[model samples]
Target: MTVLDPAMVPPRDARAAFRDGLVTPTAGWSAGWAQANLLALPKDRAYDFLLFAQRNPKACPVLDVTEPGEISASIFDGDLRTDLPAYRVYEHGEQVAEVGDVRDHWRDDLVCFLIGCSFTFEAALLDAGVPVRHLERKSNVPMYRTNRACRPAGTLSGPLVVSMRPVPPELVATAVRVTSRYPAVHGAPVHVGDPAALGVADLGRPDYGDPVEVRPGEIPVFWACGVTPQAAVAASRPPFAIGHAPGHMAITDVRDSAYAVP
Candidate 1:
């Protein structure tokens, strides 16, 4: 048997667990469908944040955005306030609370942005015979904050974030080629061999998510992450912000193939 089951998991099944307060990180579920990283902010700051995403496509590729007071996305048809496994509340650049749902924090003037996530590519990797160490070890994908600075857009600016996976040397090229086809989902590895090039000091202590062992003969591959916007939230210190807890993403109805390039 494989590390993770290859069968497609319906998005609603995962959403139901999240709505019921089962706050599990969404690394292995809802295969084949796309997963999203959510960022909700007040309408007043939406433009700046949108501009920031446009400037840093690799880290913040946008998939959908919701109108003020809207709870569902038109593109995917899921509850923004409750679909994700966990939500985070940030105030003045600091994470203040983590909750199972954000119903109490909902506001009419808030605009929600759904950013592309790296998890969308995991299904493809597993199908192509790539071993995802985290899935094999039943741990969250390790992510690190990089020293690289994303170009500033309006008031948002911060370091890039990356998700790490250990790939066998023989399959590294296949991993890159398969994932490169999906540009909308944090496409391809930004760095393949060394974490130090991105200023990541240690793989064991990630800024977000849990660490998995990198077995010998497997090289760590880093991909640009949707969490990059979280760094901006830390730096800009927006008065009020909400996001999916790292690794706890919103499963979308959209298929992963829809985001893949020719």
Candidate 2:
């Protein structure tokens, strides 16, 4: 893994930390920016996936879609193949490779989808004085695939994947109000207080990301996550799919304010 120079990390460029060799995690970089989860699929499956997102807006809010063979993301002034520090290439449900860029693997028929990311709401939570533990610890927010079934479109269907944060019971309401402003990014809590409600048997053992402590007064708050789409894609096991490695997102030029509700 490439180690990053913290001194050189840019505040807004999503790929800056990766460029500086900061491979640790992105929970804290670019404080108030919107981060995006990516989905690249073969042209043959693009329309189906787009419809899937439309039907499941909370889990797959569409940010942008790219024409086949193009890497430039107009929303972020970025090249999709290089902006994200890491990419996971999956072929038929099996992970084929994890690499820094996808240029070598690029195909003329590939279409890219930029989905809303949870990081976009962290700023609001912080402003409301709700502590985001993962950001404080510089760790990726914990994510899990739950028993909740997503409304299927075509062959895309799977349980929802959620990101969890521990919020003090007293501040739970405030956290909800703050996050609800960004509907484009899996807004608000999907569940709170009980892991069993979401089929999460163990908080310490997550399907993705490291776990953190849930203090005496804290409740485990869960939010709909972009990972849901990836889980759906993985389950379907199309001929090929590519996504950003967890915590590493596609940073768009669009400001978080652009997605916030008044």
Candidate 3:
């Protein structure tokens, strides 16, 4: 079979590759489609997380949610258990396994939440002449867990996580403007200039995903990340939970334009 370019493949085919056991970051795949971070929690804890996501909208902009026990959503037409390139399974806040398929660990009471991913806005950024360094390097976007804490909801709370992209200083404004239009996919950058301001001590060391080079004259821009929920799962110690591995997102059928604003 001829391998389709990641940018040219449609969402369904992108998901099909993942289902076929491909394990790779979704950042540059299915270019014009929206990607999502997945969080599957037992029905018993659903309402608490719903409130948690509601309270932390910037880090957890929800796009679609599946009813308890369901594998598909309105925006994502693929199998939730098998379509994502990788999954992190947590037990009492401890990640016990990372796998390509979660069917063995799946629970019938799981309620899946699909949170918007910044990858959805990357094509727009590239279109606007801003560079996404990780894409160029063929690596996962760097993610850091901040010292800042999210507002607590019921029993759920954790530090905010941010994804870093090195934008050329001259195009920083364009990067901001392009991304801000997509509010659901973590619109705009939360921090720019100094990573120290967000308590990130070292740009070379990230809490999740691989670190990339920040070229001379390029500013490291930070955006709120959907991986925040997984951080919550670790901190809050939920008995059982599942999340997309950082940078391994669900490629939904929804178009990027659906979440963009004027």
The Cα error of candidate 2 at residue 21, in Å, is: 4.5
Give me the candidate number with maximum TM-score.
Answer: 3
For model 2, give the RMSD to the true fold. Answer: 2.6
Q: What's model 3's overall lDDT? A: 0.95
Residues 1-262 of candidate 3: C-alpha lDDT, one tens digit per residue: 9866899999998899899999999889999999999999999998989999999999999888899999999999899999999999999999999999999999999999999999999999999988899999989999999988998898899999999999888899999899999999999999998999899999999999999999888899999999999999999999999999999999999999999998
Return the lDDT, model 2, position 163: 93
**Which segments of model 3 are wrong by more than 4 Å?**
1-3
User: Residue pairs in steric clash, candidate 2?
Assistant: 3-21, 4-21, 4-22
List the global CA lDDT of all models.
0.90, 0.83, 0.95
lDDT of 2 by residue, 89-185 (tens): 9998788998888888889899899999988888778888999998777788999999999988897888899999999989999998998889999
Give the backbone clash total of model 1: 0
Give Cα distance to truth, residue 32, candidate 3, Å.
0.5
* Sort by lDDT, top down from the best: 3, 1, 2
Tens-place lDDT per residue, model 1, 106-211, is: 8899999999999999989999999898887767799999999999998899999999999999999999999999999999889999889899999999999999
Worst 10 residues of 1 by lDDT: 1-10
Each candidate's root-mean-square deviation in Å? 2.5, 2.6, 0.9
Give the best candidate by lDDT.
Answer: 3
